[model samples]
Target: MEVTNLVVLPAVLAFFVLCLYFITKVVRLGKHPNLNLPPGRLGWPIVGETFDFMRTMNEGNVLRFIQERVEKYDARVFKTSMFGDPVVVFCGPAGNKFLFSNENKNVQVWWPSSVRKLLRLSLVNKVGDEAKMVRRLLMSFLNAETLRNYLPKMDSIAQRHIDTYWEGKEQVFVYPIVQLYTFELACCLFLSIEDSDHISKLSLKFDEFLKGMIGFPLNIPGTRFHRAMKAADAIRKEIRMILKKRKVDLEEKRASATQDLLSHMLVTSDPSGRFTTEMEIIDNILLLLFAGHDTSRSVLSLVMKYLGQLPHVFEHVLKEQLEISQGKEAGQLLQLEDVQKMKYSWNVASEVMRLSPPVSGAYREAKEDFTYADYNIPKGWKLHWNTGSSHKDPALFSNPETFDASRFEGAGPTPFSYVPFGGGPRMCLGQEFARLEILVFMHNIVKRFKWDLVIPDEKFKYDPMLEPVEGLAIRLHPSHF
Candidate 1:
């Protein structure tokens, strides 16, 4: 009887202790008196709605996911959990304005764990004054004067890429070749690595690295994340070797301080006499390489797709490009001013971006308790603002589904409505560089060839970034100038 009493007493005490712990947790969680959180389900515990979110993203129509939620909840701002965090998705231009305009105020920049782990020490991983300093340092190299200097080099690379990869082939895979072109350009301009074999090897590694950027942050072996982490390490090791050599060359006067981005990074310093650390430089270089190539690759590939599908638009682009070519002497590379003249072509690129944004949306985390759209948001909540909310809004863009470049003619899209490169303080630093690269590629390709899509209805899916499932094959018919 004493043994039974002892066992029962301990069991009851333990049960009471567990109940009290849960009660304390509940009281703490409910501390905010009259808290009115946004309307939506948290879904399954840790996994939450991430699977559904990713599934929709993979299916290439993430807008449907947002639309369904907005309708069901009947609210512009709705609550949901993603990637194991409570998320509040803000819809429409109002949401965009609030999030972008309020950077570092009530909110700050945030990225997924995959991005943070893979791109350690990059600008995306920075915030507050540190981010600003990095931006200024980077801008010293990516600024207007520097980009203008790269115009001819970009044109030269585009011409060479076309001659080697596209000129001889009757049919070619667009995405892979375009990827090669962008990657090669990035290597040359960023690291001064011009060797084809070296570039090819690095490109393979970057391919693996990029795959993990949006994948689940599982570091286990045999996972995409593992492969990406390994690739990042290899790429960093290669960059470190190059950095060591470049430092010696710069010191010996064999390399100019203004030679390339690597030199610029090595020599430039912030106003506070702060130089970026070695790891920071390597990580930023990796980030730039991915950003400098991948987003441009997507745009360039899509431009080709749209041009093939719409011959009229292709003709319009061709006419603008031909006029620019005609103004320049034979064998003379394009200048910045010449690229500026290709406005119609730019408009087409802009419209394509609007329809199929390279990045669907981005996230920001609340730094403190804040009120948005009459809803009380608690501290530490992840906030999301989708491009689809503005880019595809019928109110902002008339006949949003239709492909019309003329929409960008005069005043263009409303502020915060067209954010292919994002906006506010954290807007993409390489946007202008991408602009020059895309315009140069467009000018070269449209003037030289008129291509037809092998698959008229080729579908693209977003495995974090939009890509053609079949690599976007096209048949090339060379045009005589």
Candidate 2:
């Protein structure tokens, strides 16, 4: 009886000890580390603060959302949940520097689920070595030197676009027409596709696609997301068809490998002989078409609005562009050198971008647990760097609300403070292209017409992109050269 009792008691104790050990481990798993997270509520679960964020965005004062929180929390970095994710909002130049400088080290580029779904396989969705390779490939064609060769083409397209669309019209809707101009340029330079009918059709589809890009991700039929998905499908199908024909042309030696972006993408491969997949190429083409044109179109449309509102600013831009025009022969297209001479004009565009940046902010996902602003940031959390944080800061720019082109002159706003195109390794690949595009558009439009806003008090909103609510109708009075 003693032997049996001893054996049973040892077994029972061993079982109880094992159970206690697991119980301790399970409790530990349920509790997170003692983290000093930034102040602010995550709002309701799942839905979160997305409603407030979207409401402010639609109201054309998205920065107000950030500012209110900054005041409420009294912190540069605050925690909030947006679009169903816990996000840490980083405000000011210090925050911007931390995120921009630490790309792929502590954090990585991340887009919302919607963007990831739509822009799959594009460079924005890629990271590390693969992203680097794709960027290098695109830079090969989009770099300033290569784009310089296309200046004559861009100039010709601008002139023809103005002549065809704005020549005799007394009043015009600036947004749609500018979109047409930018899309046409994209089609011409990217794929060498110049058919007006085709471009017009593609532009309509692209409008649907853009509308759905930042829309709520409800994929039910009749919803914006559903329509955007359909439009994307149609556009991709068309591109695939184009790719098929181009491949045959390339194989038969009927097309030059250096003819256009599509051709360049097709024939080029990484040093290891790895060529981009057909679908990858198609996806990137779509990405470029959207990025390359949409932001520039937005900037150009607003430039017209601002120039009309502020005549003194307009006169300065006009005077600068006129000097460039005066140096050229009759009907001469703008050259690379001509664009370089439009320093003052570029500054005006820069100021407009600063005042009303097309992209409000960008997102990055923490690769691992990190600390910022004395607050612990957990792994997998999203971090946002807002343009308004710096762009609208009184400390960064004096009287930040006022429009001032001279701010960009000489040294310009402090580094990382004016990131209309972002910064670091992931800075915009098309920034130089955008600079040239905006300058050329300015040179052409200001040189030809002095305009007035039909809706003198036009209101605009950021529907995930800044756009005039009324499409910015304007009256055109041709300039007598």
Candidate 3:
């Protein structure tokens, strides 16, 4: 054709590049051992879906968006690339069961650098050795017995915040307050930090930490990740100081006077009578403060927002609190026995969790090729299971969108079907702690005030945590206290 060599070479190069791209897609599919994975759209390229995904991150109905993907594509597990990393969204009962298993151990929890860098933990998998030890320690602090011991503290904190902060307020943004209350409780019961001002600043720092968690990982001055890392440093220093103080107090035989989680960790020794090191103490404190406060605050905000709308439920909550408080002293500490009696409140809280999970999506990197139904999940592919999306699935819950609290009245289904705190070995460590906090907060608030929505100009929206992005605004009138 008498074509110039240069023109021919460039055309050949373009053809090869296109060929390599599709060839790689085919190779990825073939790499999976099983070919029976659930069906899904491959689209123009494996990575093209990412831009649309990021665009949808903070827009529209998340539940419907994910649902449509599964339904339209007949996809139980679909692969796409995000930020140059291949990701698969696993859906349906079988896909969820397979992905949820810690036994497979292939799927690594892919926490962002904002959290990982801040906490100095691995960005992927197994949490960190320090973080792991702290998780174990938290079991002791957040266990049933410890929660029982802390009931008085929970009640007192709830009462104090309600009376002092919320008593005279009409409409208020409750998210910040919930966060503050949870941090204060974490300080008293977990970190043993007693100074209100110190705890308040720490709480604000924690909020900043959470804000930075989902962003791209870089420490540029203006980036959220940088601020998060700085926040983490602050928290680490505070933990060190508190630990030193606790050590001093213990040597002085003032241990009897301290009853927080840090105190327990300080006093309790392993089977060999060896004490946990300073790093261990600091790591656990950071873990507990993050898990205990952020998750609880998010859940409580959702619960209160729904409670305000349902006057019938609100009335019953007040009645329930009254019945439980009949014989208790005004300033008495609450016990597991006290929380146990508030069955209705527990159910309400559970329902709220079902409807609005704090941690919306759980992301894991597939360690190896895995198969479910007709779909094949390739190794190293990031897998995201939207628990919030699952919560609203009609297949999983009847009348899924309606705010009905009756679903949890019965014995409940298999744990994975309704996992508000997640499932498997990594299920939330502070679940019981959160339940107690929710019960205490709800009990006191219902007894003291009748809250009404300020009536949004438009429908409210959810942030990453299922908290209202616009902030929870509501009016509260004293309920004949």
Candidate 4:
């Protein structure tokens, strides 16, 4: 009796009290006072619906999760819990519009703990005046005007990539080669690191660096994320060394201010008379290289896949390329006007992005209490918008699964519905750059060969972005033959 009273009784009593506390909290969570929140289940304690959210997305069926809830509730908005936070799902064009238009006013960008931890210098983590300043500086280099100047160089690189990787091959896995091409292109355009040996060494490290950007934030040894963090640190060190040399080049007039992003960063200053630090510039460089290569690589692979599977489309693309080729002399690079003339080719790429967007959605955090879709949204709640729900919605695009590039023919899918490059003030800064790279690659490859996929039944996985489960491999037949 003494033993029971001293230890066991108190232990059991404490356990009961803890259970009672959780029960009370759960009861409180189910009731939101007078606020009319959207209809949905929070699911399980502490963990909430995080596993369901991750599992569905991991399975590459993010749209299914959103569509099911919308169907059952007949509501465009719903409440759910994800990543240990309350999230408000805003579906369709309306949801996209709200998030894109409301940046910094009612909401600002948010990311998972993993991304925030790994990508420390990214502008995505900044807010208010700071974000605006960083964006302006980056835009100075990435805007349409500046990117247009790189078209000839992009054309040259695309031609070289084909000659080096695709020209002599009987069969090749396109994803890896395309990755090498885009990453090398990014290095050339962003850092002017055109030396094959240097770019090759960096590219090997960057593969591991990118894996960390989306991996779990755990920093333990023997983990991919840990390896990623180390790779990121090493890359930063290399960029810093380059920056040191660039400062001398800039000071001595050995490099032009507009030569590369590094030179541009060296000369530019923010609105508040702030010049970026070496570390900050390295972060921006890493961020740009990361974003610039991944999206184009994915899109380029899918472009190859679709063009290969559809013969008529391939003929049309080839015809467009041949027309462009006829005007230019042998070995001459494509001019900006030549790229602009790729209307049909652009439409095809746009359609592929719609079917399998590289970046599906992003997160936002509410600034204050607000009302959306007649539902009360409390402050501090996480906001999410998925392109898949809108892209695959039958109402937005008729026969959404059908591969009709013509769907982008006239004025394209409705506003906010076609967000391959995202939209509004915070839209992808590298959109124009990506366009030039993809169109140039398409032009060069089509004029050379019409390929057929070796793996027709290949699967796509989303490591938060579209990646082929197996690198997309194909066999090429010369277009002239």
Give the true-structure RMSD of model 4.
5.9
Off by over 4 Å in 3: 1-57, 104-108, 122-134, 256-258, 267-276, 329-331, 456-463
lDDT of 1: 0.88
Residue pairs of candidate 4 with colliding backbone atoms: none
For candidate 1, what is the TM-score?
A: 0.94
* Model 3 lDDT at residue 94: 57
Best by TM-score: 1
TM-score of 4: 0.91
User: What lDDT tens digits, residue by residue, belong to model 4 across residues 214-287?
Assistant: 53355655567778889988888888898899999889989899999999988988766778988788988988
Cand. 2 Cα-lDDT = 0.88
Q: Order of candidates by lDDT, top first? A: 1, 2, 4, 3
Candidate 2 residues 1-481, lDDT tens each?
9878765776667456645644553354246657798999878645569899888878777889999999998899999977667899999999999999999899999988778888888998998888889999999999999999899999998888998999888999999999888898889889999999999999999999988887446565556877888898899999999999999999999988988999999999999999999999999999999998999999999999999999999999889988888899998888899998999998999999899999888999999989987898888888999998899999999999899999988999999889999999899999988888888888888877889999898888887689999999999999856
Q: Which RMSD values do the candidates have, in order?
A: 6.7, 10.7, 7.3, 5.9
In TM-score terms, candidate 2 sits at 0.93
Give the per-residue lDDT of model 3 (tens digit) for 133-163.
5456557667887678778778888878776
What C-alpha lDDT, on a 0 to 100 scale, does residue 155 get in candidate 4?
Answer: 81
| TM-score against truth, every candidate | 0.94, 0.93, 0.85, 0.91
